[model samples]
Target: MGTSTAYGGPGGGTPLVPSWLGSDGDAGGLASPSAPPAGAPTKDPASPATLPPAPPTRLAIPTPADGSRFTAPRSNFTRFAGSGGSDRASLGRAVSGYVSKSSGGARQAAQRMGASRGSGARLLGFLTDVQARGATEALRSLDLEGLAGRPIDEVFMGLADYICPNAGTVDEGIAREAFIETIVDLSTLGVTDLDALSPDQMQTVFELYATHAIEARLCNDIGTKLVTAPTDPLIALRVQSQLRDFIRNGVSDALTAARAETPNLTQDRVHTFVDTIYERAFGILQTLGDAEADQ
Candidate 1:
């Protein structure tokens, strides 16, 4: 593994892509633009990575003709992201479950966006569209490229500590404190009536949460607690309950749509998808549990 000059930077420690053309960002940040993940199955040529539609007549979200200003936070981000790991995973699952209920083009795009290789937040956003638009036109108004770092409270107020803060004198250290407050807010939201809204509507509720003033304040609170303790269990339970509630919503919606779209889609198949959503979440729930234990 001796790097002569080709891989070395100015002196020897620096390294650059073999070819010098564009950014090293494609297929998201998980893999090299030209390479797939190790041992990952190659996607079918027929189902290429191009903007493959989810349905023949799917209505897509209007993606920003250009990209959004949402760059993932730089530096100290590991601390911020790791602290919110449980929330990110749980939210991703909830969003994924809701979006997967559709049988049309929205479903395809949702699956693509929610792919394991994609960002947790991005997956949540695509899922948001499905919940907002319904299975039919869910994909019609997506602005995927425009939602980067939009804010966690956009979906979960407790997670607001993960959003844009008072872009003033606060540094990362102070912002992390603000994030702590967000955790409190998110904890409160998690405990709300999960059964009140349908799965799709519940996801919409999260979308609304992301925009409300309460979430912003939560972020401010977390920012005040910088290197604080992990979020509480009552909060964790609420988040978990929300996850299950979200799954219920998606399952119910999927069953309804399946009956209408492919008359052949059996109740059993719908159950299978619901189970899939639940199963995807088990790992996240475990992580949340562990975090609570540490507290």
Candidate 2:
């Protein structure tokens, strides 16, 4: 089959989307750019489906100072170029140009995808929904091929696996690993680039991961009042940053320390501001934990 596969002795095989690919939905405003709809690609005997995405030599990390800014940074490339990027071979470069290349790319994705299948988990479907939505957003903002120098599919697969390996199969631990990796990876993406992500693109990221923001409204009315209305609003600032850091680092350290504890630990002022997310996030966690225990 390897030697004869290229000969095309039989009539051209069916022209259809592969079974591995699914019909990704258009999430609200997110857009899904199908990988380059190339003439039915001739499969290499060695490489099925498509060649693997280029492995990154190094991860691309935005400067930490620049990371703190909420505005769109300078365009490393021109505006999103998915439509214009050449699909000649799929991605031109690899993951490095778009996101950081960590030590465990393939092994991690494979592990996540593999473990999910073994866990009798429903996490994959949920994550697939998430990825498709995120993919939609990322596609709209990115230069699909020029960024990769490959077909949009390569970009999609690269991003998809990176974001949710074994999206439809992984267990909780693998799912958690993949989720953390994705958020960390997205942090490197420019705000403009992230804001430009298609629905499918945004789907892979988190609901709370806002790329652009205004610092002035960092807190709501209640929060301002709770902090003695400090001009700096120190405590509220501390919590917000702690949550942000948790999202990035998975809560390794707590924001509140004995020495740093605020003198004013009273008043219901901040509760109004923090209650909404705290209630919801905690509720979801409690519910999920209960469900897992029951199972």
Candidate 3:
């Protein structure tokens, strides 16, 4: 039997909506402009109603209480809480389970974002490209506007398809890891609230998530290698150091490229993204060590 990889975090629970998406009027959350300064005067019945809330001028990632930066958790399998197995087979069960537990609001939010016929096709292409290549290339090659306008479900379903192309044959554990990684990546993009985004902007966020997922998975693989190796202590130490450097350099390159490609990228977001990569790398190392010690 294949030994289970303790990917970290308990699996299965309600999907946590990004805090920014909350209805509360916190910074980065919904904006309800001070009820028009204590209602100085009531406007005409319908004199060209005020425009929608302006898109946020700035975005920020939440910081932890300990004053450390936020990093995406190793897994969000709790979103699939109560699912049977912890392995990849459990991933298959979770996938089918989520379809029936669809959130009406999530669906509506997706529809409002544009789940029309033509847009769905474009969304599919964009998702496919992001999965096959990295998010950066997908952004450069795909129709950003079209993909952004598609429904959230369309984008998510596309991701699901990519994760479980052949339910019968795909490795359940691998699929689970990909799904968790994607969630963690999306979380780092600081876009909990979809209303804060335009179609094109949303597409960019998706691309970023996809790219990060790919990177995170690589880090996880490296950590597995480090922990599982039965080599000499000195050689293992050298290998561990090399793997850590590789992850650091890779993250730096990705961030630099992302900033160059999207000038509007916020400093906080970039920092959070960088922290996420390092945190995952280090977290994996820690977990691997713990597991080996127990062995």
Strongest candidate by lDDT: 3
TM-score of each: 0.21, 0.19, 0.26
lDDT of 2 by residue, 1-295 (tens): 0111112111112111112222221112222366433333455688667664544334233222222221111121111112122221111111111111211222221221222222112222323332445434334443342333333334434454433344331122333343443345555653224324554343334332211000011111011222222235454345334323322221111112211343232223222212222223322322332343243
Q: Tell me the tens digit of each residue's lDDT in model 3 across 232-264.
A: 556544543443343344334444554466545
- The residue-by-residue lDDT of candidate 1 on 244-264, one tens digit each, is 344344433433453355434
Q: How accurate is candidate 2 locally (lDDT)?
A: 0.27
Regions of model 3 farther than 4 Å from truth:
1-159, 162-164, 167-176, 185-190, 195-222, 225-252, 255-295
Off by over 4 Å in 1: 1-109, 113-230, 265-295
Alpha-carbon RMSD, candidate 2: 26.1
The pairs that clash in candidate 3 are 12-77, 12-78, 12-80, 12-81, 13-78, 13-81, 88-172, 88-173
Query: TM-score for model 3?
Result: 0.26
Candidate 1 global CA lDDT score: 0.31
